[model samples]
Target: MADNSSGGESTFTVLLALGANAAIGVLKLVAGLLTGSAAMLAEAAHSAADTTTEGLLLAALRRSGKRADRQHPFGYGKERFFWALIAAVSIFVSGGAFAIIEGIRTVLGEEAEQTLAWVAYAVLGVSFLLEGTSWLQAVRQVRKESAAEDLGFFAWLRRTDDPTVVTVCCEDSAALIGLLLAFAGVGLHQLTGSGIWDGIASLLIGVLLTFVAYVLGRINKGLLIGRQADVRLVRSIRQRLDGHEGISGVVDLLTMMVGTDQVLLCARLDFDDALGAADVERLCVRLENELREEFSDLDEIFLEPVPREDPDIRARVLERYGENPLSTRSAPGGATRSETPSGE
Candidate 1:
């Protein structure tokens, strides 16, 4: 057992991003209307979509924090993932799809006056600064999560379970890049006296949004279905178990995310040869306490004591349960001695 809890860092981050996007959306809408800039209009629509998705993400964080009940023993952690997936889908349909269609329409239309193109550029400059601010916040969180480890940003993004964290990061990065494209498109159109360059910028923004939406959807879907913690976290847990005096070593350790900030840990431990049943019980309690203190994200823990080097019994257990018996797939009758705690 461990202290089951979640955090508010994700909510705070989403709130900041939402405010930025809301302001950006308003600015783009006004600029697009005044100048008839295709890129500006597409960016406005994209900002609108982002605002809606962030609202959904905030709702998810709220729902997933609910306490567990009889019918749902695992609590509502998956709700966060469900909303996250919806957010990704919305990004594709509302932002990416809409942008592509707008780009095509603009590409085929007649040239507009370059008189107000300057307004679009001004809006883009401001939007880029705001988006960059949001992105910096996301990157800071990632670095803190990795314990100051200098892993690549993409690698960390794939490994993290916090949907809001990655969503905000990806969205902000896309927005900054989009602002650049818009600027280039407007600049080229102003210099060349053609609308083709502006349309091309809209096209590029749409393609970029589509790709980012795809990545977010795939990652969130995995979390929604139940994904294990990263390999690095698992190895770290193993090290902790190995260092404990009463335990010989960890035979196997497995983990799965039940919520954005909650994880369930299950492990088979090999007790020291001289420890008795009472000693084993006390050791289990002590180790669990240690783990809870060390890993605030852990919500639950199941420790199964067994001999680390017992080949005969290990083979039999493996044959019956396949992998990770804690997942509810077990031998006939749905209960077995090997599945029992401490080889009882």
Candidate 2:
């Protein structure tokens, strides 16, 4: 099932992030103590925050996968969004805020540059390797899913309806950039014999983390508020309905994503008058059955029928719905008046 697959992927991604963070944290902590580099210390804090967030994400994934209960009719799907928000907050407070403070102290000349700074550089190099591996894994997963939907990697990451994958990718990328910043800072400190360079690097790393957290927060907000399905998908559904029997054309259509893969659909369809109300009812049933068969992820569907012989009916429906109606509309003066807004 889609839910099962999603849960599994989330679990794997969380573990991957946690594993990488743990390794990097150890390296950074050791490097920071040996070289006393502000940037290295900042990076260690970032890694620590990342590890904590990963643990929270895993818990959220498990809770979100729970079945619907009497208290929560929609299930615990929104739990992911809640935890994602918490993770972003953690990044901002633990990583961004702390780095900024440390960078300021270093810049104020309160701290002295460590003479033996090579250790920081060595640790940064190793951290980069580990972070890069984690990033690659997340990218690979996104690519696999995106390819099925005919999207490029970055485009997919931006447009993906799944917040968990987006969050993981964003965090990994920020961490990779932080490693580079630390390397640059330590290298400069070694060259200039000044701790200010290290401080500047920490500040920059904080800025990057803040930016990434903001983006992730925006994505999670959209997911929580509920976003409409892609327009192209709605058009495809319309095409399908147009092909059905007794259905003249699609008048109106609306779709919203219920979850990552699930969708809710509502449509207004035109039916030939030759088919009475009973016949139209049967046609509606058939159309619903066909759609369900075609798109297994469709959750709820609503079909409204209108008489096809009315000249202005389709126009009115189109005007109101902003899509071509499945059936034709009635003219201005006729027995079956245009009850709805027409595209006159």
Candidate 3:
């Protein structure tokens, strides 16, 4: 889950990438036209794709932030995943496809003489600087958010619910590498007087963009389908439930990420047989309030009182967690202890 600060950071990152890509795209177009470098043209397409992606991401952020209404009881959080998925498709279609086609045509057709090569070089250098600035901003945001969650950078990225920052980071990183590939293509063409290197460079850039698109697409797909909340958060919730005085044991716990910073949690617990109906009702209300206060990301919660030793429930838990599904014990302080559940 993300915080308000992370959301702001994501917006800033997207805006920066948007500005840089827009400017870089125009420059690359001009340079490609003047130089007749296939790689330069491919890079121009890359920037165009990135610029369009940024616009879609802006829409994602805005639409996904809408408040829940009758039409969408869970809010519009999944809109972000949908838009991000579209952006990935845009990258592959507009950028990778164009670059690949251009590369093939240039390689097979009559080799055109590279002209005004210096212009391509100048454009690539400027584009690198702008893309690098955006990349750095994205890195800073990811680092801060990952640190807040007490997870390694890559681990956090893989599990993060926020898609805006991840998309920006990946696009800018690809842009920078594409610029380097363009530079190499131009330089080699000028030295060897062969457009083959330029074509090869374009092919490589296409492949790179395709790979990035695939990775992001897979991520957004899983997210849109629904994924579990952070493992640490799940563990913390289970520990709290196990330690509660009224709860004899936890039968089952379930969680899902509903939005960028929202989670839905459901817990089945075994209450003490001594507690009356009124007491159990009060305890349930108290637990809901307390859990929400403790973990701000818990947007929705449901607690069900159940018998811990029910055969049906025990079988379900066992099916999910193997033989040791009930990893419960008593500590020296008379506190209930439980390990991280396998369901998470």
Candidate 4:
């Protein structure tokens, strides 16, 4: 279960981030206007960008939830990756780039005094608290999902298949850092009566955002291209097939994660020697039904019967499964028999 965030939990997190950002963005703009602070203005833009990204993630969640169709046999799950990529780009451009430009413009052109500086400080406190609330929810989801596999939290996050969850979490984290920078920048400007501190803070915030966006973009690109399904699910499916009385040995197995909760599986296996055509057909149906029951996330499981000596198919099987079927036997060039299953 790479992304157990397949249900309402992820949407709730995105909505929370959206709400927090929307409120914080307005406050930041007001504070910036009142204080004439460049850092506050950049913070407002960053918040506004985060709100837009959250909306995109929500749309991805909704659109990717639809069932498989004739137009898309694999279902629309990849839409989550698509929208997450867009959100990452938006953060880099709308948030990071704009903030840098604003910072540069302010440093070059402004000699303005920061009036009502206390108001900006007050807004920073409120924004930090709201952003923290959103961040906690995202972390809770991440921790819950990671603990089930005994995997380190950061390890799970890197390969998480649910883009919506990752997007919201990353955005909120960057928002928190940006808020701190804004606060420090404003404070320094007030103390030294120098606008350079504000401009410098804005630049640092932009760099932080760019780094987050770059990491997110690369990860989402991998998802769009298709990463392997969870290792747990892969091993589980293999073990389940081996346990089936009708199956002799698995010849080939392929899995694609077409959605957060939906996985498409195709397996080529050796059935019992005595099974007739009708028996094999019935076994396929039975196996598919059993797998669906055991692993509800299996959107489709197509079991194909193939002989152990299939040359071309064996090559593909070796390529995908990364094991030599012949060598897996007691004798050379003999087929491996799986009367019992084992783990890696």
Candidate 5:
């Protein structure tokens, strides 16, 4: 559910990575076969894994965009998160595991003659250029998104609901580092006439891939478990609700990121007591329309009218916030109207 421009950027980035990794994978495989360098072979597997990851990301973008249906009233936004999780697993199994096993085999087996050391060096040079190109594109997209959100780069990354860009960026970064490790292994093996250095480089590449996989896996796991929406978005919504005229107080506000740019929100509000039921219904309809106009990401909303001083409600809010709940007033029946400044 990312906006049109954002969704287009994500697709373009994935395609660029897919093309780069596909070409690099072929080149690395040829070089590895000719030189018998475990590190080079590991790099080849790494490229293959990256290529697969890009494909899966493409599917994620496509499927997650599906329109809402009977069974899935909330739509298919979380499909992106599910596929991203699978892509992380692919990195570990196809790339990391293969590299570790190959490293062990080469280290324990007989020495391999470095016939095409020059070929590996040439491939590495070209691969670096390709990978660098892909990496720059990902970085540019990340920076643009961060700026739009008025947040720092790393902060945006942590809070971003989109997974395709993150997946591509991380994969490309690991690819670049793996290339360097392969270069070192190939260079050292040729210089010393020992495959041990080559095996060591392969092991390092495995560890690098494993770490990337773990980081990505943890992120997607949190998303699948339903993380809260962006802090800024939540705070803005709360502030808007507080300033509304008829709304005496906001009892509870809940938000969840259902998809890349889609949010599900529920707000329990205390309206003016003198208002009639018909007036309250009209206000509810108007408020929903106004909120949707202001916040395009709000995909679904539920508004409940409740007394602000309800004991059970107060108790539940206290348990969640532990004294600093996101309400206009500090306590029940405290401030008649909100005096706290915006962004509190």
Candidate 6:
């Protein structure tokens, strides 16, 4: 199961980003028209794309939470990754591509006077405020989750392996940066009467968005393709299995990430011969129970036992029979071979 609190918090943050960006996108579109600033237009496109992505992300989160079925034994966790990839693509196509085109047009001497530079400034300020709020919320969630995992915020973000949160955070941060760039461009164009500065800013914002999209895409791809879990976690599980009673040794272990925090474990244990079949069964059960108790994220556990006495079973039985061979006592009548043994 996922961490409900964290998931909910992340979902809330995404919704906030969506709401904020939707409003900001409208304002930016108006400002872009009023000022004819390429940078403002690019910012508007970026926010619009972000809004769409957030909506998709929320849908993905819901779909990914569906229970496993016969057709999908591993559940629908990858749905989140799939939607995150879609979000990245949205950013690239809607935001990056638009920005690039607008920038190229502005660079090609398409000069439009900033009829409403003040309007752009006002919209950019509002955009900054909204994006900042969303970004702060995302950062807070990351900090809280990372602290729980004993990792720094950025480290946790990188290591989390959850595409939704990572993508959302990246988008929010990029939006914030885009807002700053848009403001700078508009300000420079107003100050120097040079639309080229605005064009350059648009180009830079496009580059930033594209880079962010690529990063998000890579992360989601890894999750979709089933990346391996942390080695430390696997080692910890192996140590626990090795230390269990009735387990002679841990021969092998395997772990796989089934979801954000869920894992499947397979372990091979060597058991002493003196341990009975019933004992082996009980040990396996207990070990699985303990593992579940210790690691709530461990979803399934398979334990195989190697018996210690299979090689000497017959020899040991024969030796025991020889040592206690029937008590030979002298019978009242002269001992016959059949009567030689009193007990058998």
- Writing each residue's lDDT as its tens digit, candidate 6 over 252-322 gives 45566667676777675668668988988887788889999988778678887743234453244344334
Q: All candidates' TM-scores?
A: 0.79, 0.83, 0.94, 0.90, 0.94, 0.84
Which runs in model 2 stand beyond 4 Å of their true positions?
1-7, 273-277, 305-344
RMSD of 2: 4.6
Clash pairs, model 4 backbone: none
lDDT of 1 by residue, 196-251 (tens): 88888889889999998999999888987778776666667777886889876566
lDDT over C-alpha atoms for residue 140 of model 4 = 91
Colliding residue pairs in candidate 6: none
Per-residue lDDT of model 5, residues 261-302, tens digit only: 998998989998988999999999999999999999999999
Off by over 4 Å in 6: 273-278, 305-344
Question: Cα deviation in Å at residue 311, candidate 2?
Answer: 15
Which is the winner by lDDT between candidate 1 and candidate 4? 4
What is candidate 3's TM-score against the reference?
Answer: 0.94
What TM-score does candidate 5 get on C-alpha atoms? 0.94
**Superposition TM-score, candidate 1 onto the true structure:** 0.79
Clash total of candidate 5:
0
- lDDT score for candidate 1 against the true structure: 0.80
TM-score of 4: 0.90
User: Cα lDDT for residue 131, model 3?
Assistant: 96
Model 2 earns a TM-score of 0.83
Clashes of each: 0, 20, 0, 0, 0, 0
